[model samples]
Target chain A: MLLMIPGPVHLHERIQLAMAKPMIGHRTKDFSEILEYCTEMLKKLFGTKHDVFIISGSGTAGMEAAIACFSKVKRITCIDNGKFGDRLGKIAERYTEVDVVRFEWGKSIELDEVEKSLAEGSEALAFVHNETSTGILNPARELAKIAKKYDALVIMDGITSVGGDYVAMDEWGVDVAIVGSQKCIGAPPGLCAVAVNDRAWEFYNEKCPFYLDLKAYKKKLEDWQTPYTPAVSLFFALQEALKIIEEEGLENRIRRHRELSAFVRKWVEEAGLELFPELNEYSQYSNTVTAIKMPEGITDKELRGELKEKYGILISGGQEHLKGKIFRIGTMGNVTIRDVVTTLACIERILVKRGIIKPVLGEIEA
Target chain B: MLLMIPGPVHLHERIQLAMAKPMIGHRTKDFSEILEYCTEMLKKLFGTKHDVFIISGSGTAGMEAAIACFSKVKRITCIDNGKFGDRLGKIAERYTEVDVVRFEWGKSIELDEVEKSLAEGSEALAFVHNETSTGILNPARELAKIAKKYDALVIMDGITSVGGDYVAMDEWGVDVAIVGSQKCIGAPPGLCAVAVNDRAWEFYNEKCPFYLDLKAYKKKLEDWQTPYTPAVSLFFALQEALKIIEEEGLENRIRRHRELSAFVRKWVEEAGLELFPELNEYSQYSNTVTAIKMPEGITDKELRGELKEKYGILISGGQEHLKGKIFRIGTMGNVTIRDVVTTLACIERILVKRGIIKPVLGEIEA
Candidate 1:
């Protein structure tokens, strides 16, 4: 079976085996070594000299941790262009005063608009670098530059892009970059790694909730431990997945993801389906997930159902307002060229059955 | 290797295998079923008809979730006896007006003293049923009764007790009981299960942190989902562990734990070591973790190191104030009589080698 959803993608075989490793006490010397090794590997993947802390939860937990711990300013500006971007705004609203810069669901965050919002006097700005909902990659470096010009800290959600796309937290001047284990890391879900720079730590609030406090995480990291019990098996899995990434080299892995994304996008165009994000001068498609407009006659349920039931392949549907109007195919994690080809073949067969496309050269028989 | 720590215990073979199960999309029908099935199993294990939700973190996360979501009243009473109880108090203090009822470590909460404290008017009462630091089981049923008499809600930290000790949440009038996966459930560490009654839900606050909010958890639970991405592999491991518990029957499993505790206590007495908790009319020993008074001749580092290096066994030392004074042995999770016997044998050898105890006839030979 092929798992092609946005996250919790099919894990590599080594990661699965690593999950079965014997349990160790969280305070033992063995665990301390594993924690140190994993932290070093994560720092390399994040392309940052800043500290990285692993929280034992999903990506949202990482997002919340950033908001809860880093939003110490009087006002926070959140750029909302898609579902994940909107989520950032909502989470920031819970902790501090938020100025939401809203955009259409399928569009990218315009640089001029984001700069204008930041110019309105904000202490920190939060945004999603890669919007998973609309399959659009926001201009992270440009936005971070603008935020820095205003002397405002930048919080970037790189959950879907950190391991798959190019994310340089320090180089981009991102105060905090949030990442998840199950996306491009090819590990199981449950761990969220946040790359935090010195600027963010300088503003750390002592009043932050204890469970989500970054200062506590920093203190525990000094001891090579977490403040609370972490997902031990998931840590083992993440270590193995990072080892695989190191062996393959980070640049080559990013290139492999780009190749897979290009292959999927090309196939979609050849099949006469429209890509959701407009390929314009300002727009950049995500290298992890590709959103495609559903054909007029094919419903999301029908297309996804046929693919899942007949071919054992799973894809994602549009979330929130765009539901049923668009479908998404994830190309990140352990997904290979073969998996993408198989998914495209399944889509072609489903489209043919729905009378949206015609089979060519004995395609129906095959 | 014997994993006799407080958590991340030696999981059963089936649970370990479940951790290796293939990944699935969290929004898929397959995940919905697994979520629903695991919730039901958790409710049964919690001995409650209340709603149960699993958060992808450690027991500390569950503790904070309860404090963050349920402490919206005028004043909360936190019983602070040991490290974990004081932690509850500290978390409560962060969110609401907390009246900490302090007690000495390794001593039970006197019912009269608790009643006197509750007479001062409180909206809620929070305490740990099993104090991992002191290895004492408080009088949960009676203390909950006193809290209910004052029309205050009861929040229980059942992290180390749920699956090993008998925990009748509904019978004890507990509004919320927090449990962890790696303790008595014999699963990997990642998930925290919270059982909440209707009364607790009535007080759910909109001001609660988004990631730890109960209302969002409830909304997602209705559709058999979580508000945030959960640790999916950990859920699979928990389900398998719960299945093992169901097969053994909760009563039988509780009884097994009791027998293990008895065995360990008898062995400790024979070896001339002292139990940490004083057995009195109001005091009860925990069936999960047993704290033993460290002898004068041995240091925590020396004793634990020798055991781990020579015999591949892992136990726990006390936390904070009790760090060097007491050592702990966990009798919970998938630990068996053979494991206990082996640990005892290893301890005997180490003690004799350190001149803390003398070897008997055939002891050295064996």
Candidate 2:
């Protein structure tokens, strides 16, 4: 069976085997140095010239840390376009007093709207780079530019963006960048990958809460240790995943993911179904999982169940209000164009046999 | 090499193989449900009728969570008699004002000392059962009973005690019980096991901090989920470890550990090395590790290093203030009397080689 959700994306057997090994001591001299070197490699992956720290929590945990580190303002504007975008808002609610701006679902943040919110609140701003809920990858670099224009610190939820493409943290004005192991990192869940710009660390240095304080972690990290006991096995697998990514060459890996995404979009278009998000603003990182609206007379639950139960393919149904209205598929992690095409072909069969859509061969699956 | 320095006690081949399994999607139905089951089993392992939550942190992280949760008061009194006791004091200082009730390094805590302190202050009392740092297991049940009398909730660190000894949660009247996977649980590090009683959860139900909030996690545990991504591989390995424990039967397991402790203590006395701590008031849970003061001129470091480097037996050299004074030989986990006899033979040889005592060995390594 092929799994084509945003994350946890498909994994290679080598990575899985590594995860299954007997766990080791996190305090041992052997694992400590492995941790030290991996952080350096992660810094390179984020394209940032700074320290990268790993937290033993999920992507949302990283989101919580970002808001905790940048907590000078009571009113922070969140540009939420999808499910994950709303999650960013949810995490911020724990720290910041209010969310100033929230965008519509399946829509990218309007630059004018962002600028207007920042001008009014003059506080911090956060949004997701690739909103997995609607497959709308925000133009963070351009958005960050607008944020910088208003002198608001910018942070991004790069959970699905990292490893699949170049975030170019330095090149973009992103102050805090967050990634997770389950996404493009090609590892299991339970680890949070965080890279904060020098500016954000400066912000954290000045005003931050206790638990999410990265500065406290940085001092401990110098010794290649977390202030807390880390998920040592995930650290082991993550180290291996990075090595594989490094051997694959970052550029080539990103290009392959983009190729897979494009292939899935072409097949979806050919199936005569309307793509939910604007085509021009689609995410290149996760292709197969787009917010696909149910065509007339077809419910998202019926289509997903048919494809999953009839064929051994696992795809994600839309989240929250989008449930029974939209379904999501993805070409992330170890996914290839072949897998994407095969999944589409399965969906096509279920749709036609159930009188939802006429049978059509996907480009690669056929 | 025999790894007998308390925990990471020793690894079986099957567990190591389990750790090496390829990574899985933690968010997937397969992985989420697997972890969900692991959480349920962990509660049973703790023998608690209340909520049992797993934190993807260290034994210290478990302690920190306890501190963070039941931190309703500013003054926390830590019962100190050894290295781990001081560590609790050190950790409490970071988040709260602390008071320390002292006992000597090689002595079990006197219940009178703790009772007297609890009567003076309106603060929670913290203590460790089976202090790995000193080979002295304090009478946690007695201490919890006294704390209950004073209306002070007890936070007990049971990292080394849980799997090896019979520590009844509800019967002992302990407010919060803490354990870890790496210790007597006979698994690896990267996870901590916690069981919060009604008394502890009462404090947790309020607007506690986020990362360390036991209440926030309690809600998630209702569905067998963590607030953040957990170390999935560790969770898998722990599930298997608990099954192994169940097959062994808890009473028989504890009995074996107690017998092993007596065997080593008897053998050490026969070898003419003085045993540290109160003989009657000791740790039966971790019977393998025995900490002894160095003979007249022999340093603890020389004894431990020679054993590891030459004999291929790894024992713990002392930590902090006890360094170069006491060396620890642990016999917990899957080690047996043969291991103890072999290790004893080596110790006798080393003592003779260093001219501390005459060589005497009636037992064979096999």
Candidate 3:
């Protein structure tokens, strides 16, 4: 089955079978051994030597923890480009005083705007490395550099970027990088992993809620345990997925993503449908799935339904104002060139059949 | 390895193999189908037609959500018989304006006190059926009846009781029953399953926080979906565990627990160790692991550490004020009579070596 949605991607059978197995006690020496090994492996995946803590919650939970832990920072600057960016601002606002710098939907966040926002002497800046909603990827490293100039901590929402892209957590000057299992990790959701730099640990120790407190997670992770009952089954799958990632090599994994994204981009151009995202310095991982702005009379949901119901392809529909106007196809994690080609071919057939795009004879490569 | 802890028993290769499988999409039709069936099966396990909603969190998450959703309650009465009961009170205090009825750490909750507390006017009375921390099980049915008399809702913390004893949800008039997958359900600890009666639903709809909102969970559960990326792996593990419970028959499972608990009780008596809990009203599932009150200079932790390190057998020490004052061994789950006998023998050896208790004269039953 084609799984082109932003998350809950098609997983390998190893992960599936792992979920069906018996569980070990979290406090047992055996589970701790696995937890210790998995933590070390994830640190390698995150490109951090500091520490990787796993929490049994969604990505939002991790975000909440990050925001809550830095309460000493009186003002948190949130870079709002799309849906996820707006959510970060909203969550930060709930717990801490936050200032949001907004941008138009489907637009890449300008580094200059962030630079100007940081001029206010805010405590830190929060930005989404990959905005899954509009397929816009911010230049996180550049933003991190700008934030560093102001001596501010940079929190990157690398939820969709980490494994699919070259995040370079330690090399990028990113203080805190948050990622989820469901996205590029190619595992099920429910496990949110956050890597805290030495500096961020200081922030965490001083300011945070009890549960979202980073220091608490760190202390627990040191013992190779979680503060709560973790998603052990998910942990098993991640161990396997990370092993596969290691075998492929991080650079090779990123290269595969780039190849698949480029293939997807080629098809969109051939279809002559305008790409929704302004792809200036966008995410290489997802390549920012394009919204096919069809002929004026075409119905967006109908096309999506045709592909999903008839062809059994599950593509993501647009959110909010972009609803029924855009359909996104993710290109990440175990998705090969062949998978991309077939999916695009099916999509092209659906478009031509719907009379939205003129059928070009043998334009699609099988 | 000897695992006599309350949960996370020594898993068979089959259950461990089940957990090793990969994850599936939570929203996709495939995951929804599996989730739907799991929900139905859980309803059967709980002996209720009430809607079952699964959250990807620890059993405490279920308790928090239950408290969070029942936001309209003017006062929730938390009955504390032991450590777990006290923990429930602590959690309820976070969301609901709670009224707590206290009992001594190892003492049983008096039905008269509970009935009197209900008369004081509370919207809900929350109690832990099996207080694993102190191994004291409250009379849930009688409390449920008394709570119903005050026009109050009944929420039972069945984290250690649901799968081990008789939990007649509808028959016992329980409005909300919270369960953890790790205990009697015989799965890993990720998802929390809750059964909410209609009256509880009304309260849930009135003022629940959006994320912990039971109404939201109910909507998703109906369609076999979840609010967030579920602990996909644990869900399937739970599915298999529930199937085992069904095949064995609920009565047979409960009887096994009772027999095991009785066997452990007999061994403790033969060893001349004093039981910590009220024997008149014991948890049929887990006989309160007694505090030997150690002879002279011996500490519980020192003895427990030696037993674990020497024999690779793990037992639990007491919590809070009771820590290092008492030791606990839980008899429940897929554990057999042989395991009970083996654990008692291990304890006997540990006690004799430490000069805390005299070595047994007769051999234990296999």
Candidate 4:
């Protein structure tokens, strides 16, 4: 079976084997060595020389940690252009006063609006770098520059973007950035890596959840250990997955993601379908997933169900209000051109049979 | 190498192979079915027909969740007899005013002192059912009875005791109970199962950490899903481990744990070693792990180091202030009489070579 969802992506055999390794005590020297190696590899994947902490929960847990630990301001500005961006705002609201700049799903963020909100006593700016739900990559570099002008700390959710795309966290002045192992890192779900700039410590709040407290994580990392018992097997799998990333250089891996996503986008256009997200000068299409608008007559159940039952392929449909309107095809992690071609071929077969598009000469085999 | 530590005990080949299974999206029907099965199995293991929520973090995360979600009182009584018991108090202090009834590391709790503390307007009682650090099983039933007399909630940390012992949570009136995957269940670490009685919901606090919030878990369980993306691979391993427990029968599993712990206790007596924790009429020895006093003139480094280096056996030494005074051997989840006998033999050989014990005729082979 093929997994083409935004996250919990396909796992490599090496990672699966790593996960199967015998259990070991987390307090032992052997486990500490593995933690150290994984921490260093995660630093490289996050594009930061600053501290990176591995958490045992999902990407959403990392998102909560980033907000709860660092949001010590009177008010924070959150930009919500999609599902994940909205989640950032919701989590921030729980910690402090939040000013959420909301946008329609799949629509681009307005830079002026973000700046204006930050100007109104907002001491921090929280947003998602890549909105996986809508297949749009927000302008992280430009947003950081704007936040810097207002002297606001910048927190970015790089879960779907970090390993698969270019994320210059330190260069962009991102105070805190988060990534999920199941996404572009190609490990199983349950681990989250959070990178923090040294300056971000100034905003640390003691009221953060005890288990997700950043201060505890930083202190424990001195000995290459997690504050609490980590999911040891997940760490093993993550280390192997990061090693795979190291083998194929980060730049090369990013190129692969870009190429595969581009292939999917081209196929959508050739097959007479429209891209889901609307982009501006700063906003761009996500390099890890491609979202296409569903045709007028095809229902989500019919299309996705047929794909899963008949072709053994799994992809995600639109979430929340966009349900049945857009379907997404993920191209992150260990995805190859062959996988993308097969998915596109299956989609073409379904559409042609539904009378949504006419079969082109030689295109069916291609 | 054998894992004789309290947690992260020896895992079976079935559980390891289960961890190696391919990834699946958490939102899919296939994954939901797996979640439903694991939840039902966990309910039985917890000995509660109430709601059980799975969190994708360590047991400590579940500990914090139990305290942060339910401690909505003027003051809560926390029992501190060992490392984990102390942790319960510390986490509770973060949520509410805490009255900690402290005891020595290897001493048992006094029932009268607990009643007096609860009498002073403490609306809840938080304690560890099994103090893994000192290898003592606290009197969970008696403590719950005391809390019920004062109309207080009962929160128990059953991390190392739930699967290996008879934890009648419903009968004992335990409002909230927690278990870890790395303990007697013999699954890999990183997942925590929390069972919440229906009445406990009345004490729910909105200030709980977003990632570990019990309310969110309860709401999501209606759809047979976790509020956040779970550690997918760990869930697979846990399901397999729980299946093994089902096949073995819970009563038989508890009996095995009890018999193995008794065997260790008998060996300790014959070797002229003392049990670590001083027990009372209500308190008892743990069925999962055995704590033994270090012999005179034998340092922890010498005894444990020799076991690891020469025998490839892993055991735990005392923690914190008791660092060199005691050593613990675990007999939980898939551990057999042969494994215990082999460990005992290795310890006997080390003691004889160090002149700490005399080699008796026919006893060495036994």
Tell me, by lDDT, which candidate is best: 4
Per-residue lDDT tens digits for candidate 1, residues B339-360, read 8888888888999888886644
Task: Provide all candidates' interface root-mean-square deviations.
Answer: 1.0, 3.5, 3.6, 0.9
Measured by TM-score, how close is model 4 to the native structure? Answer: 0.98
Q: Native contact fraction of candidate 3?
A: 0.53
The candidates' DockQ values read: 0.81, 0.42, 0.39, 0.84
TM-scores, one per candidate: 0.97, 0.89, 0.84, 0.98
Highest DockQ model number: 4
Q: What is the C-alpha RMSD of each candidate to the true structure, in Å?
A: 2.5, 3.5, 4.4, 1.6
How do the candidates rank by TM-score, highest first? 4, 1, 2, 3
Whole-model lDDT per candidate: 0.87, 0.73, 0.73, 0.91
User: Candidate 1 versus the native: TM-score?
Assistant: 0.97
When 1 and 2 are scored with lDDT, the better candidate is 1
CAPRI grade of model 2: acceptable
lDDT of 3 at A17: 66
**Candidate 1 on A42-79: residue-level lDDT in tens?**
88878799899999988988998987798778889998
Model 1 misses residue A175 by how many Å? 0.7
Please provide, for model 4 over B1-366, each residue's C-alpha lDDT reduced to its tens digit, 9 standing for 90 to 100. 888888788889999999899888889887898889989988888899999999999999999989999977889999999999999998887889999999998899999999999998899999999999999999999999999999999999999998999999999999999999999988888999899998898898887888888899889989998888889999899989999999999999999999989988888887778999999998999999999999997799999999989999999999899899999999988898888887888888899998887654236333
TM-score head-to-head 2 vs 4, winner: 4
| Weakest lDDT window of 10 consecutive positions for candidate 2 chain A | A279-288
